[model samples]
Target: MIILAATPIGNLGDASRRLVEALETARVVAAEDTRVAQRLMQALGVENRPRLIALHDHNEREKSADLVELAREDDLLVLSDAGMPTVSDPGFHLVSAAIEAGVTVTAIPGPSAVLTALAVSGLPTDRFTFEGFLPRKAGERASALGSLADERRTMVFFESPNRLADSLRAMGHAFGGSRLVVVCRELTKLHEEVRRGTPEALAAWADDGVRGEIVVVVAGAVPRTVDLDTAVQEVLLLTATESLKDASASVAAATGLSRRTLYEAALRARTR
Candidate 1:
């Protein structure tokens, strides 16, 4: 069996009872950083010195098979430096390999930056999507945000402090300056701060620079309501530069209208 354990994001006291017990008994542990795992065990007062194996982004794919094989004989415990493994962290490939090999996989769930940030974000949490991390480059980031311009579910994203300002600036452009955003910094830590405002507001604040692990939660786009005739006209205009299918899909996505309805309306309008 393969055990994926969640580690505390910051506060050591948040470590669950099951996680500590797993650490104590596990014969082998695959960690994103072996050094960090060692430190964590020390911090938790766990005396058991399990064999530590490095299983990070650099080697997760290569090590998955071996890890699965190892698990066949003994429970293989997986840990990231912080939070749950394979959640924008290492362990996804290993879990997939384990599942494919018919190896049982289970999780010791605990702290999660994604869920922590979302819960404290004050945004609508009834429905949400975790966006992981944004592209590092400005152009790529913009293109990614642009694609999600019409996302209706509240969005969660992990971001580095250094790039937070620039990302927020691009978000202001893509998601609009007035869009509500929450920046959760150093969550569950000494300097934990949650700043809520428009993207433009937060962008300006982050321009001075910020620090610590960051999670940004943004309110979903307001659904656009448009009549079929108006939507069809918009689709027709886009068809001048895009395919009929592409144009219809784009307009439908933006307007929250049925793609088939838009396509048919635009098709009939084009015939006229």
Candidate 2:
């Protein structure tokens, strides 16, 4: 059997009973960081010393098969530095390998920074997305955020402290300064803080130097209420008074639809 354990995100108290029991009896432990695993064991008062193996993003794929081989006979435990394994952390490859090798894989569910932040974000969470981390480069980040400008589901992203201010600023430009957002920092810890406001306001707050791990939750775009046929008619009405290009651009800008798409629709309208 292959057991995936979720360690505490920050607070040690959040560790589950099954996770401790798993750790105490396991023969081999594949950890993201061996030192962190040692620390967790100490904190949990777990005396059993399982043979710790480092399985991180840099080497998870490479080591998956070997770990699965060991699990064929004895139980092999998996853990990430925080939260559940394979959640923007390493463990996915191992899970897949275990399945292929006919090994039973299960999880000891516990703390999660993603769900925790989203629950307290004050945004509609019925439908949402977890965009692990944004690109480090400015252009890539802008392009990524711009692509999601029309996304109706709430979005979540993980970001480094140093880049938090810049990311929020870019989001303000892409999703707009008025878009609702919450910056969750050091969650489940003493310094835990959740700041809610527009991206612009949050960006300004980040300027004071935010610290620790950060999770950003942003409300999805509320598309214009205009339907497709109505939007096409509006384009036609504008084209009667202006050039097709100008009309399409104006309608597209107002409706938050693609300008080229609107232009093509306008041409079809002329034919029809």
Candidate 3:
């Protein structure tokens, strides 16, 4: 069986009893960083000293098969540097390989930076989406955000401190200056901070420099309130150069109106 374990994001006390037990008895452990795993064991006062194997982004694909085979004989515990493995961390490939090989896979759930940030974001949490990380380059990031400009679910993202300001600035441009944003840093740690403001204001504040692990949560876009008459007009205008079906879909997506409704309305207007 392959076991994916969750490590503390920052506060050591958050480590779960199941995770501690697994670490104590596991014969072999694959960790994102063996040294970090060793440090974690030491911090937790776990003296069993399980054999640690290095498994990180650089080598995950190459090592997944061998690790899965190893698990056939003994339980393999997978660990990332922080939080859950394979969540913007190493281990996804291994999990996939295990599933493909029909190897049983289970998890020891615990702290998660994504959920931690989202819970305290003060934004609506009824429905949300986790967008792991934004593109690093300005143009790529802008294009990426542009695609999600109309996303209705609250969005969660992981970011590096050095790029936080620039990403926030790009978000302000793509999502507009008035969009609400929450920046959570060093969650569960002694110096944890949660800052909330518009993307523009946060960008200005982050310009002076910020540190530690960061998670940014942004509020979703408000739905447009265009009437059916206005919406059908848009569909009709686009139909002059495209298929009615294509135009209906395009206008419906932009206005959050029903595609069929727009199509039928436009069809009726055309007949008249």
Candidate 4:
């Protein structure tokens, strides 16, 4: 069996009993950072030191097959430097390989920056999407933000401290300056803070600089009168080059308008 264990994101007390047992008994442990894993084991008083292997982003693909092979013979524990494996972490490839090799795969669910931020974000969490991180380059980041301009569900994103300002600025341009947003910084730590405001407001605050691991949450675009008309026009434009269904989907994504409404509007426009 292949176990993907969830380690504490910050506080060591967050580690579960099952996680402790897994760390103590597993024959092999694949960690993103061997030293960090060792520190965690020391804190938890788990004396058994399993053979640790580094499985970070650069070496994940190359080392997946080897780890999967070991799982076939003995229990192998996969962990990231923090949080659950395969969540913007290093365990995805290994988990995929283990599954394909007919090995049983399970997780010791625990602390998650995504969920932790979402819970305290004060944004609607009923429907939300996790966009792991934005691109490092300005153009690529702006393009990525633009692609999500009309996303209706609350959006969650992770970003480095240095890029927070630039990211907020791009979000303001793409999603509108007044878009509701919350920046969760250093969560579960002493200086943990949640700043709530419009994207523009947050951008200004971030201009002075911010630090620590950050998770950003932005409310979805609200439909407006002009936006409805624009949606009608977009649907007509796409319908001119594609099928009605495809056109409706595209317009709905671009305008935050209901697909059924856009499709009905398209039919009426076509008849006229």
Candidate 3 structure quality by residue, lDDT tens digits, 106-176: 99999999899989999999999999999998899999999788777899999999999999989889888
Models sorted by lDDT, best on top: 1, 3, 2, 4
Q: Each candidate's TM vs. the true structure?
A: 0.92, 0.85, 0.92, 0.92
lDDT of each: 0.95, 0.91, 0.94, 0.89
Model 1 Cα lDDT, one tens digit per residue, 186-228: 9999999999998888988999989999999999999799998
Give candidate 2's TM-score. 0.85
Q: Per-residue lDDT for 72-127 in model 4, tens only?
A: 89988998988999998898888888888899999999999999999998888899
> What lDDT is obtained when candidate 3 is compared to the true structure?
0.94
lDDT of 2 by residue, 185-243 (tens): 99999999999998778888899988998999999888687877788888989887899
What residue runs in model 4 are displaced by over 4 Å at the alpha carbon? 226-230, 240-243, 253-258, 264-272
Which residue runs of candidate 3 sit more than 4 Å off their true CA positions?
A: 233-254, 266-272
lDDT against true structure, model 1: 0.95
Instruction: Give all candidate RMSDs, comma-separated.
Output: 2.1, 5.7, 2.4, 2.1
When summed lDDT is taken over every stretch of 10 residues in candidate 3, the lowest stretch is 247-256
| Between candidates 2 and 3, the lDDT winner | 3
